[model samples]
Target: MSLPTKTRQWILASHPTGLPTYGTRTDTFALETHDLPALSANQILVQTLYLSNDPAQRGWISPPSQIDPKRLYVPPVQLGHAMRARGLGRVLASQNGNFAAGDLVQATLNWVEYAVLDAGDPAAGVRKASELPGGLSVTHYLGALGGTGLTAWYGLVEVVGCRSGERVVVSGAAGATGSMVVQIAKGVVGASYVVGIAGSEEKCRWVESLGADKCLNYKSATFEADLKEACGDGVDVYFDNVGGQILDHMLANMKQHGRIAACGAITSYNGEAVLPMKNYFDVVSMRLQIKGFIVLDFMAKAAETVGKLVGAVQEGKIRVGEENETVVQTAFEEIPGTWLRLFEGGNQGKLVTKL
Candidate 1:
């Protein structure tokens, strides 16, 4: 195979005030072609195959003025630079001893057709992706078998310590990580009952199919009543994915000493302000435990977590891929729009762009 001398990229044109728009007059990105330079020693050049579009991208592209210096995770994408994104790619060529051509890897490949990465950069967090014994696809590494599954597993197992007969409720229930959490709660932990909250009836139905005892459509006028009724007794574990009004509702419905896993807050990602929780006092009154976690926090346990999830998957206990993902295959030029779809509720489960 011959290496291409040029690569196309979507450069960050400007930061957005709220929800991001792309490929339009007010687009936040600009497409450009650039020369692909030769790899330096200890560098590997990768051809991107798939890109992971995540809610975190909103925080990544937030204007510096809108972000508090103390709260930032990864640094924001600089203006005129390739838009930051994680991707599954193949090693097209390598000058590094740790990698070789034809190796599949997962890393921060950005929004470019090709990228040259330093093999030793810890920030890159490159990992070799291999087919699992259970016959999971490479794309699963971006989803159920990767961060999505890991996030669900780590939060439920490590953070919440979910146990048998506990009642589990997951917000963003039909989404990638939320869906995984729903299945793991019922299948892996043997939760007596599991409930999911999603934005629409269609999504709620999908969540139910994932083994939830019931799924609530949060968009309905009677959402609060429905949620309260479904809990009946109380929620023992809450896997919070959207942390706004839904969190407030969950707070009100928690059992004594219930555990809440603070995952991503998709609802607040596009908003200018994250409102104060109205029922936050319940934490003290009910002796509840609220814990915030990022999947990166458990890198030391990645191998162990994956091993458990893989076994559950192989046994058909924890399901993946039937409504657990939405993948878009398009030309590289459409990549920007595809990412923007995340905020628009344009996808179900894990959103991936096949480049």
Candidate 2:
């Protein structure tokens, strides 16, 4: 098949004043079209199939000048550059021996329809997505059975060392990674009690359905009391996705020597002022282990972890939505608003856009 004449791309118009805004193209990404360029040797041209919209994307594209230099996680997308993102795509053409036409791959595909990817960049090696149980979506390679699930696995199993009979609490339980953590805690770790904190009653129900023994709505008036009641005895492991006042509460309620896995900080992402944690002193009193980790740190075992997550899904243990609620898919043009939903706290599971 001949390559497309032009590719639609979302160029970063400018850095956001705070969080990225959807209205008015100046605040964040602006859509642009470009003619397809030549595919040089050792490069593979891919058509983006699914694009992941993550909170980290916000931090990665935030203006470095406005953000604290020390706090920057990933490299910021340069102005007028394609918005940075990870995605699953199909190799339409290739000049590399390792990859070929019709191969499915996951890579640092920009927010564009098509691009040429050089070997060994931002995670090399295009994985051949195959050999899954019948009826499973390949999109899982980007969500539950991919980096998202691996992040949850690495943080809970490797970083926090979750064990059987431990009482676990998960913040942002309704999210893509957090929901996976709840399931892993319930099935793999056999936790005595698994509680999740979300923002809405409906989302709380979804969290519970995903295997949490209990779920609490942080927006409710009795959220703190409900969380305390759900913990009952004490929380042995706290898998935190949102880092703000909830973290302070988790710190205070944690059992002595309990482990806290600091994964994503959706609470403080847009340069918003961080909430005061009056209970940080509990870190000393409770001997808490607050550890922060990046999923890529465990890439050595990425394939292995992804296979295990897939098995759990196949075994009917981990209830994740790859094409349904677990992942929300939309047109590529809606990415700005779709990403903004992550901070708004109502987005279903992982946010992905179909190109």
lDDT (CA) per prediction: 0.88, 0.82
What is candidate 1's local distance difference test score? 0.88
Q: Please, what is the TM-score per model? A: 0.95, 0.93
Tell me the tens digit of each residue's lDDT in model 1 across 68-187.
645876678888899988899999999999999999999999999999998789789787888766555678788888889999999998899999999999998888899999999999
Clashing pairs in 2: none
Candidate 1 least-lDDT 10 residues: 18-27
Candidate 2 ranges with C-alpha deviation above 4 Å: 22-25, 66-71, 120-125, 322-329
Give the winner by TM-score.
Answer: 1
Error of 1 at 25 (Å): 9.3
Q: How many pairs of residues collide in model 1?
A: 0
